[model samples]
Target: MTTKHLNLKFSVKDTDAIRNMAKSGRTAYAIALWFIRQGRPVATDEVLRVCDDMGVKVRKSA
Candidate 1:
């Protein structure tokens, strides 16, 4: 089996857009996961901050 990995990188504008989406009721994790599936995983801290700023609660995984 073989695996491929891609470094997730986003510009300031992209981060702003993601934050805006979070403010519009989008789940931070969902946004992060979307990027991840596209081979661009976002930082967990960044996502969590967005969720917090937007007053969204992220359920902890068991």
Candidate 2:
């Protein structure tokens, strides 16, 4: 068996926000899995909606 490598880039701010939410007692896995179940995703724009609902503050980046 072989494993493939993939690259994913998230802004420093978004990474920080994810960390903060975890620190604040939100289960990161739950958020991700919930979106997966909904056939949505963790894409920035989509995730931001979840973040906004969870009151997660995100710094914008392009």
Candidate 3:
């Protein structure tokens, strides 16, 4: 069996765009998934903060 992992990378421009989207009321999950689709790593803290500021409640899974 063989396993491979994705190497996520992002540029300054990408971060800026993500931040803009976050500020514009985009959901954290949506934004994070967007970066994942592009093979980029999203900053979790930033996303969580944005969600908090925008009153996006994150549900806990059991």
Q: Kindly indicate the candidate among 1 and 3 with the higher TM-score.
A: 1
Off by over 4 Å in 2: 1-7, 33-40, 43-62
lDDT of 3 by residue, 1-61 (tens): 1113222343456545656776666666777777778786666654565445444543221
**Consecutive 10-residue window with the lowest summed lDDT within model 1:** 1-10
Error of 2 at 61 (Å): 28
RMSD (Cα, Å) of candidate 1? 10.2
lDDT of 2 by residue, 1-62 (tens): 11132214344454555657545655555545544665756654544554554456544342
lDDT-wise, the better of 1 and 3 is 1
- Looking at model 3, residue 35 earns an lDDT score of 76
Worst 10 residues of 3 by lDDT: 1-10
What RMSD, rounded to one decimal, does every model reach?
Answer: 10.2, 12.6, 10.9
Best by TM-score: 1
For model 3 the TM-score comes to 0.46
As a TM-score, model 1 comes out at 0.50
Give the residue spans of candidate 3 off by over 4 A: 1-9, 41-46, 49-62
Can you give the TM-score per candidate against the true fold?
A: 0.50, 0.37, 0.46
Q: What is the descending TM-score order?
A: 1, 3, 2
The 0-to-1 C-alpha lDDT of every candidate, in the order given, reads 0.58, 0.50, 0.54
